[model samples]
Target: MAAPPTDSFTEFQTNLTQTKAQSTTTNGNTVSRGPSPNRGASVPDNEAIGPESTTQQKWLTEHGIDKSKWVKLKRLNHMRYQHEDLNVITTFLKDFGVKVVKKTETERWYAGYGPDQYVYYARQGPRKFLGGVFEVDSREDLEKLVRDHADTLQTKGIEEMTTAPGGGSIVTILDPEGFPVNFVHGQSQRAPQQMPEKLVVNDESTKPRARQFQRFSPGPAAVHKLGHFGLVSAKFDVLREWYTTHFNIVPSDMLYIDLPNGGRKEVAMFAHLDLGQDLVDHHSLFLATLTPDSSIPEPHVHHCSFEVHDFDTQALGHQWLAEKGYQNVWGVGRHILGSQIFDYWWDTSKFMVEHYADGDLVNEDTAVGYGPAGHEGLAVWGPDVPQEFLH
Candidate 1:
């Protein structure tokens, strides 16, 4: 059986603050405090959400997480929000990588990420967590993404222009479902410099392994540009269709869950899809299953993953985690699909945070075809998942 609720919602919030203080010295940059606790009760969007006053750190701690483990709190690395329609949501996300090819405000905007990309989006009445945005390498990248994805850019109307902290320009648009979308460019107007030393990549092996394959050419660039997202939805089919049609995301594989006979006979294991980029291995997004009878309204991301330069960064994270006394859920396991070494830990909010290296890159000529369903699909090369880590 699922774990029963322990503390009241208010007590949960209090515990969160106290736990974070015990975790780390690095207090992440505070953004607009996100919506208050769900209060185990559904509420309207316009209605003041719980209390806007709470900090993300406090909220995260409430759920048994530590905030300092995250490497990029000061600069938002990624975001995920929700919208009513898939077309509208896809339109905004595509701005990050590919430009819209042909958009008719009447036609749904479904283009985003790349061919093998996977993204998570959820819908619940008028509220949603569409998707999170990541910090980019440069201003040229911002311009380039807009140019490439311009063909797919579709929006009903956009307003609420503002400036980001570093002078980055910000714009907000509504997806087909009425979710808010935000994009920023030319912030700080500075040249992309070396990412922090802690963020550097390291792979010293000169001899190539017989079984290991590197499909992509090496440079400062990586094949999989961004991270992963997990979206939740009651209508998984609708959200899944929207993602596949517009984003060009292919279904690499899916996971199904067998509920205790009282419920549906079988639901998917997490649905795994891939953004067809030879530059990176694994799907850019993974959608966990949700049924209509559940209390949550929409299917959305379970969590997101960031690409560290190499295994050295992963080592740094592991050491840091041990030094700080935070929990490690899984990994140092290598995934067969992406060929990336993995490590999983809980953040201040207890969301899974993945730090990885050496992911597989997929392109036209050398793509690996999708495989059949089963436990093998999730980790072509890792240990079986422990029960406590499944959630």
Candidate 2:
């Protein structure tokens, strides 16, 4: 069967003709459009995110993670979100730079310019997250996942992905916290959609361009594909073990807080696929402990991040979303861990989505690094980290 006509090329360039607009302020809080006043009151710079958020400095140390078993995953495939209204989210998805792959009254799937058939999947109803999906290395791996977790609640058995845009097979497992994680083996692949070529830069040390003048047309920083996402789990230790031991994910970096009297507690981690000798993104998934001070009652996803071209594209994309009146959650900053220049926003459903650029990559040979937990480790520079964004 043929893939749905997503109008990938044409739709990516949509809204380019619309005149750029600025954000309007309501009461006093400046809602995320371009530049605004000093954000009213003085917000603290890089404050820790929990109750007495620091542990003893000595607790910061490196540790080895055991990767005993493996269910090989080729890469992250896509993410799913259940929205209150498909129409509203569809509108936001376009602004977020994912082209429509297929749409129905109750379901819609989106595609990025990347080879992955679809980058995001949405369902209509009360807002909910369906979890990120991964493409397993082989059908045998999918079989292993089902067989290994057969008796556990994680098992739902393998089934054909009939309704999906690109027909394939999928198996979704519920992790320790009941977060749904889907695994796929077979899916049709498509040629990546055409994108603007990379721009050349002339640094102080060297000048590359001699005569060509640089210019750009404002538009959404069209997405390349999904980058990475994070979760704050009440049962952090269990989930971390379950993921790394069961699947081929290993930590690249670990964040811990020192205890008052003795022990050290790891609060967050950045993990990558354990593809030996082959380099992959510094982190394909992130996990963090739910600090006792956080108001959120249960374990849940933090945000889903997507990859855009570079700084200029991300900036324009930020401008486009802010101009559209979407609330900025946090970002337009460089993170200390993965080194991604990130921009985050609250989607129509109030879930956070991110646009990121220039992330680091690692492989099995890269030794995991450890650090102390604090807001300073979050970003190297950008707008002040919003309090709402922490945790």
Candidate 3:
């Protein structure tokens, strides 16, 4: 998908540097004050769910995110997972479109056509969440993370990731909810793999391919890169504060629910990196709040999403997986939030993975939005969202 133009970072930062904002809260709770259904309500302090400024320089300063204090992440590197049967999961992944990078009896490394050497890591054993791996902008950025949570239980010294492809230094930190989040530095890049030709299409407004016919082969939607992943949490507020405070993560949209006494609870947050003037995916992570009375005993992962080339590529990929008898989860629709055309399926291990295309992108200037939490608000159009997909 085409991304928005990114302004020159050097110039943008130079023009807008200032002290960061202090943490602000409402009644000692999170920032999801119930907005009027028709319009956004003012959040406590200036943390309202709206873009306070249009320029990246202005947005950064407003959010109190300066280069030195915030750990700047370059991109989502990969996701690591463990399954009871390596062979079973491997077969499913191949049909799902990733090329194996390196495989042993117990471990498998997978790659997409993107610069990342590996995008998904699988290991044999019981089902377990290994963590979402990220590539930080600099070694200093990694060190900044170390300094932020130095004495916490989540702290771990950096170590060489010798066994993984594109050996790099990595440090693992557990979020307050005890899920591992890895940060890496200095990994070798991989060359791009061959991709399907961009088929020219003629729409009602534009006739671009006058003499050509569009054709495609049935195949797995070959992944381009790891786009984003999601998590469900009972401690949504705590998790939100930790991530938004420590990293350059800021909200694109914050979904909430109103309480009996006219209070507000943040039920869901979709956030993106504050890359100053650079354009990036509308959201890199989605966190949904687990209601206290819900049957789920603990927080869990929602799914891992990958990017495919276009609509044709995604449709073909969807058919391929269905023919292979994989259980379909919720998707083949356009999400209202990021506007991604999404398709999700379950791996042999029961973990959800998605292939999406044509998603929205934003810079720091994009406004933070607020909406109600409901299945009806999920998609602009698609098959009904599965209840199984929720909890």
What would the TM-score be for candidate 1 when compared with the true structure? 0.46
Candidate lDDT scores, in order, read 0.42, 0.79, 0.80
CA displacement after TM-score superposition, residue 129 of candidate 3 (Å): 0.4
Give per-residue CA lDDT, model 3, range 1-391, as digits (tens): 1122234443333333211122348899655433322211212212333332234354446656555666888888999999998888888988888989898888999998888898999988889998898889888877777777676525357778788889998878888887889889999998767776888878779998988877677889999999999988888888987887778788788888889999977789888887877988988988888866544558888899999999888999999999999999976888878888999998998899999998888876567777788889999778998877877
lDDT of 2 at 183: 89
**Top-lDDT structure, candidate number:** 3
User: Please, what are the lDDT tens digits per residue for candidate 2 over residues 259-312?
Assistant: 998888988888888777887998999998887667665788999999999998
Candidate 3: where is the Cα deviation over 4 Å?
A: 1-67, 151-156, 292-295
What global local distance difference test value does model 2 have?
A: 0.79
Which residues of candidate 1, in runs, are more than 4 Å off?
1-77, 80-130, 134-156, 165-190, 195-226, 252-282, 291-300, 364-368, 380-383
- Steric collisions counted per model: 63, 1, 2
Q: Against the hidden true structure, what lDDT does model 1 obtain?
A: 0.42
Worst 10 residues of 1 by lDDT: 67-76
What TM-score does each of the candidates earn?
0.46, 0.82, 0.82
Q: List the residue pairs that clash in candidate 2.
A: 55-258
Local lDDT at 377 for model 3: 90
